[model samples]
Target: MSSAAATLKQQKEDFVSNLSGGPVGEIHAVAFVAPVAVLLWSVLQSRQSFFQRYGLLAFTVDYFLNVVAILLAKTLYSDFPLLLSLLLAVPATLVYVLPPNAVSPKRKPKVPPSADSKNKLDPLPLKPFLTSYRSFMLISTIIAILAVDFRLFPRRFAKVETWGTSLMDLGVGSFVFSAGVVAARPVLKERAEGRSMPWIRRILGSLRHSIPLLVLGIIRLLSVKGLDYAEHVSEYGVHWNFFFTLGLLPPFVAASQAALAFVPSHAALALLISGSYQMLLETTDLKAYILTAPRVDLISMNREGIYSFIGYLAIFLAGQDLGMFVIPRKLNPRSNSSAGVQRNTLIMTLAVWTGVWCGLYALSTNYKYGFALVVSRRLANLPYMLWVAAFNSALVLALCVIDSIFFPAFYNAADPKSEKEAYLTATSRILRAYNRNGLALFLLANLLTGFVNMTMNTLEANPLVTVVILVAYTLAVTSAAVLLDSYNISIRV
Candidate 1:
């Protein structure tokens, strides 16, 4: 490479490195744990016509809640997480406290004609909380991936070098966990219904499903090297990335499918695997080798990624366990499908997730003393897995509480067609859209991130410039996704 090009590349890498990791990711997590619930409760507490669903303001609010909230939290309010959450949530609270018709519905009411089948919106249960939460994780991850490269994002929210919880550190695990949850639709449902399947067939099926991911991983590895991108080797190591890690997990999950029946619980399997992995890390020279070994060979070159596979697998399995718990008892015998989360299941889900979150929190903090093993994204260690489980459960727990407060039924037979009533159910519209083809959206975001990086020098940009670029980037992304959703076009592989 030319001297000037090399110099620019080095400067770019350094500029971004100095901008990452601290308590901000954790603080943001704490701040957001309850606001989504608070917002829903506020909106549902009464017949408030002022804040009509799908109204421009409502869309703005919902859009921010799902797409923009974390972006801004990690950027403008990184230091004032609690305040920002309140700032976003207080309006929702106010909407509830306000009297009905407080803000008059602006649109004229249209009388409903005789029953029209085509215009009907089916009860949108489609695993409401699960899909919505997954979308939230995906959205946050996509936004942060690009934002972290800019000076606008808080350094504190970047991936930590070692053991600690940061927004970026949470991204990989959370993505894997969410993928695992959805990926388990058939596996869990079959288990629930007491069906038998050949273990080899199941493993082969998983391999087939994994082809696209494996291909994508290869593409990413080649593209990064081909372009001579600035890579932080300590994160995933040479030749390994998040894609490969995610891609390899399914086969393992499938291979263990038959063994799942023998195990008392999926959680037990997860614990067994992760616990054993941790033991390997501690009892042998494995941990030191992974962290400190020379990168003379391929295995050593990608020690972080290769070794961390066990940890990611555990996270994925835990997600599947959660999925098994949340899915409706009535499985679709013809296909692996997740519909509306059964209302009857919410109570137990709420309790279990709440308890898990609290238990994990207590254990991780050692009763406020400090983490026994600080969360290490690099190692994907026990603490890291536990943290992912805890945070995701907490997020889901919040959504469950929202569901309990808002929906009288988990899946409504039909939704109100009126524009005003649509607002009430419109909350999940964008989220559902993103969830439909989440991998596509992530891929698009990566491409866009690459384009932006190549086109401009993000590190030297002022905060305002950075914010504007981010907003534009997000708007472009959401708009495309929404457009595709509106057209019923899902780019699913």
Candidate 2:
């Protein structure tokens, strides 16, 4: 490389490394969830005829405001995330729940049919929240992957150097966890219905399914070195990358699917495996080897990725267990469940969230220890696992509330054989698009990240310029999936 180019690459590398990250508090993470909640509320509760006539324009505005605007605002206006949440939430709550003051008394407005009236309609055996969760993770990740290089993105929100919580750190873990949730969906349902696939079949199928990821991992490794990309060596060690971690994980998770007969429960198995791994980190030399060892050989070079895999595996397992609650059970079309069952599910979710937080508190606080174990995304340690679970489950529970309120029939039963769903608004349409074509969308974003980096000096861009580029890049990424979904395209691999 030329001296100037090499120096520029080094400067870019220094920008992202050694970030301390923001404080670990619920208040800040609220920035991430609030806009989404409001967006879904706004779009889903809109009258259907209004959407059919102006759907495209409405979706464009809502998507820009909620998804794109929130993405930029969270970083640019980092000081008052809670305020931002309320700004959107207060208006959304009022608009969705309250009667408009302008209407005359003679004309009665329409409200959704009461749940009592829909007693016979079965809830569609679909989990829109699960899709939304995955899309959120993916969207945050795609935004961060490029946004991190720019000055507009806050350093405090970037991944930490060694051990601490950060939005980017959670983003990675959430991606893995979300992947686990979706991957195990079909198998979990089949097993619940007593048609669990044979162990050998699952292992083989998963491995086959994972080939594209592994290949993409290889391509990423080659491209970084070949292009002399600005890489933070400590993030995943000298040679390892996240794609490799993601690619290698499925077989292990698939094996767990078969081992369910022997293991007591998915949650127990997740905790057991992760706890055992944590013990090894505490007792043996593995932790040191991962943290401080010289990068002389391949294993030492990629120690971070190799050692972190076990923790991620545990996380994926936990997601599978969580999926049992979040993903709807496939009921016979004739089966009619009461609205009470929906309330029961919500109650159970709150209970689960409570337990998750309590476990997280116990681990993080250790009951007045003054200093608890810091979360280590690099090591993917126990505290990190709990933190991921706590963050994700909390969001899931919140989304469930929104889904119940506006999309009440979401948890309603319907014929599994019927048309999947009929979402009216653009935001839901686009989110489902992203979910259907997740991996492809991610790969496209990575490619776009590379292209944008190579073409422009991201480290030097002004705030307005940064936003412009990010918006264009985001539009390109989102539009591709939306366009594909418009044509009935779904790319699995």
Candidate 3:
């Protein structure tokens, strides 16, 4: 190697060594506290006009905090206790510094509805999209994190057997589950409005809608195979990629929905079946067969591409059920009258779900027969599904809480219209940008990852340099998503 190349390589090695231990753990700790910080900022800054005039500025501040946190992890505080304390202190201090709204409530002005209002369906609400946006952003962040935290940085901090790895695996399931939920919502709503379809017809209809995704997956798979990209066989399989999972899983999910339509507690039933399957795998030699099968046919039968899809399907169904439960059944104009009631109901439901999550987590942890929670992305086991569901529910709940507390103030200041009208427009454009073109963003990220890997020596890059690269990659993808959304172009299946 040349003199400059050798120096760069040494720097990379030294940075990787540091990142492998305390720095990486601190980064994870910071990540765990980020949502809280953002929430606190939103609540405390409710009266500020800065967010109203420059919504992108708000997002920028949030992103900047995250970057700073990463830097802090690398430099100032490598210990979890100190880092976490600082994270907690910032939000706690803000709460005391920022006073609650002291302005008197404004009187509502009622407007007589036009004749056309009676015939029109109310606009689709933005609240549901809040969860959708958060999920999409999370998936994007995870993809970025994987590029740096797993691929570029040292492997010691991102070990495959660790809880962090397990959480990332759960995130994969959560991302797909959220997609399934959003896709199923319109169908469920139509059914609720007495436009029900036959189960087989519904299944087939879903498959039809998924045709585009299937085609894209095929194209991607062929491209990867032809290009001979670095394949993570252990992650999925020789022929299976994330895109393939996204494409193929929908049909099975639809089939599950159709088959289980008669069951009142279908989500619970799916969860039960997943647990039983995991138990069977644990007790028998089936896991070995699935993991070590020599032939492609046999391997596909057990790989994350196929059999593990069963658990993912279950997770999807559960997400659909949760979506149905959370979203309002009717979007009639009068539904706005009960917005507070609806918010309270969602909060209550979230609490109940949290209880369920805690119970399951405790049971899984306490079980003595080796039936403990085993989070295996390759297997998509029961515990993993539960964790994903639970975490997602909590996240949605947090967003809703933030919305209930601060969004109204922001909305009122930003718009002159009624609260109901303003609520619909409260969603940030940045979020809408990602939510509208999430698939495109994911595809773009993958393309960028490949491009960057080819152009730069990612595995031998300095940790700080890798972070900068990841941020740049994120910005490029996000900008594309935002720009596409601005043009009203959504790359949907």
Residue 287 C-alpha lDDT in model 1: 90
Which tens-of-lDDT digit does each residue in 314-405 have in candidate 1? 99988877776665433233443433444545556657775875576457557457456666788999888887877777677777556556
Query: How do the residues 443-473 of candidate 3 rate in per-residue lDDT, one tens digit apiece?
Result: 6777777677546666656757766776676
After superposing candidate 2 on the true structure, give the runs of residues whose Cα lies further than 4 Å from its correct spot: 26-31, 34-40, 43-54, 97-124, 330-337, 364-371, 413-427
Candidate 1 regions with alpha-carbon error over 4 angstroms: 15-20, 28-59, 100-125, 191-194, 329-345, 364-371, 409-426
- State TM-scores per candidate: 0.85, 0.88, 0.78
For residues 1-493, could you state the per-residue lDDT of candidate 2 as single tens digits?
9999999999999898755777877324544554355453444344232233335785685466546755755566666666666666666655655553332333222222322343233332446666667777788788889999998888777788888777788888888888777766676557557785778887888887678888988899999999999999888888889988888888888787656778887777888888889889888998889999999998999888888888899888877777765565432233455655755655576567648655764666464762366688889998888878777777777665555555554444353221133233222666777888988999999999999999989988998999888888888888898889777788877
lDDT of 1 at 384: 84
Return the clash pairs for model 3, or none: none
State which candidate has the highest TM-score: 2
**Candidates 2 and 3 compared by lDDT, better number:** 2
TM-score of 2: 0.88
Give RMSD (Å) of candidate 1 vs. truth: 5.2
